[model samples]
Target: MTPRKGERPPVPEPLPAPVVDAHTHLDACGAKDAADVSTMLDRAESAGVDRVITVADDLASARWAAEASTWDSRVFAAVAIHPTRTAEFTDADKAEIERLAQQPRVVAVGETGLDYYWDYSPPAAQHEAFRWHIDLAKRVGKPLMIHDRDAHADILKVLTEEGAPETVVFHCFSGDLEFAKACVERGFVLSFAGPVTFRNAAPLREAAAFTPADQLLVETDAPFLTPHPFRGRPNEPYCAAYTLRDLAALRGDDVAELASAVSGTADRVFRLRTVTSDLPNGEGLR
Candidate 1:
């Protein structure tokens, strides 16, 4: 959970097609400066990980993600106060996040939701902040990205009660098939991370299989949850190729088809408009 060694994992081979690292902390992934962000994108692109949504966990990060989205064409942003940081979530913080949500490049209004795995923030505060973010997402007309830890039922309850935004994605989804069904029925997208590629991640694999191609997504959650073989090493967007490959094998699906579906879903959900050469003449921004 700390430094993943100065020497990060080598970038794997390119995927059959490009995909999105739906949720990653580029600023926290040894990419603190603008140059670092650009270099990271260059590396990611080489592996067919052409686009990324660098997410922010706190106010400072929210600002950085907003700015970073503008630095490189391939990078977009997701702004939020992570649940652990929700204890300090204030009116001012909410106001700023609301402002950031309106930015063109800030595609999603979260990575915000319930997290009972830690006691850094009390449940009451978490609930209140979660509701605020849900409302914020609705008001701003952006997708809501959730960070659900061990609080599945409560997360679902809050979304149901407050009413969800037009688009909702459970970043680093850790739910079982039943919970997965609940989210899908509500039109929520489940994003599979490196954990889905593990031998012991049968529950997650089941959820992946149950998730329709249209409702399915994948992420690196980079600098953490690196997929198997590279499990505890370190992660980056390029490694999303590994997870995509494994997911295809797990579900008995075609890799190229899966890649196309995931990338297309991300472009649609996040409203990415990367002006990269990867796009044919007047092809994307969907």
Candidate 2:
């Protein structure tokens, strides 16, 4: 239909492209309403972020993420009780988590681990909850997405003692280079986030530089830790491009190539079967 006088023209359609965002909190990013989620996904799609794994750290958010996924093709959900929120977990929580793990759209078992920096929950409770989540991951035969903040040693010790699922990912990895090496050695995938693009994040950048291509992944961790150019702004999936650029620079590879590599790693770790591209290693991104 032709527009009337003084009417603005319609926006051109965005080019269809494939990109994967390894981590983000869909429910925590003001997407609590259906309209908000639709708008958020629309922006993501316009920016070429084809798929995103929405991580929920508690039962309420988990249910929200799962329900949101059912409404958006590009959204998938990961449910777990975050370390900080572990104090809220009860026996009912455990049962609910087990039942949620069986859902088709729910792919991984966390955003769960130890966070010493913010002792929102007691250390002992965090430890117990962390182990329980790990056990749940093993029982469900799914990958685990872990969050470690200033508790790398404890996290490593727990993973070693209790053993992680076959597919374990250190999401938004902020550890030192030594820990990065340790994680790779332990067969854990390290998912870098916007922090890697920060000027003072030398340790994170160093870890990014040395991580094996196959063991590396990328995420946005949106609504927090937005990359340099957008550091103080509200982060979203599109900002992952800056992270991709930084990672490619760190590895001295093409941006598209690095994106392909991390996308493949994410697909494998998340058990996604319909990714949009293939890795340089000749493996399907899925």
Give me the candidate number with maximum lDDT. 1
Stretches > 4 Å off in candidate 2: 1-17, 274-286
Q: Residues 1-286, candidate 1, lDDT per residue (tens digit)?
A: 6645545677878888888889999988889876888888889888889889999999999998887877777888999899999887878998899988888778998899999999999999999999999999999888999999999999989988998899999999998899999999999989999999999988888999899888888899998998887778878888898899999998888988999999889988877754332234423322
Clashes of each: 0, 0
- Candidate 1 lands at a TM-score of 0.93
Compared with the true structure, the alpha-carbon lDDT of candidate 2 equals 0.80
Task: Please list all clashing residue pairs in model 1, or write none if there are none.
Answer: none
TM-score of each: 0.93, 0.88
Colliding pairs, model 2: none
lDDT of 2 by residue, 65-183 (tens): 76776666577788899999987679999998888877766888988999988968999999999999999999998889999999999998998899878999999999889999999
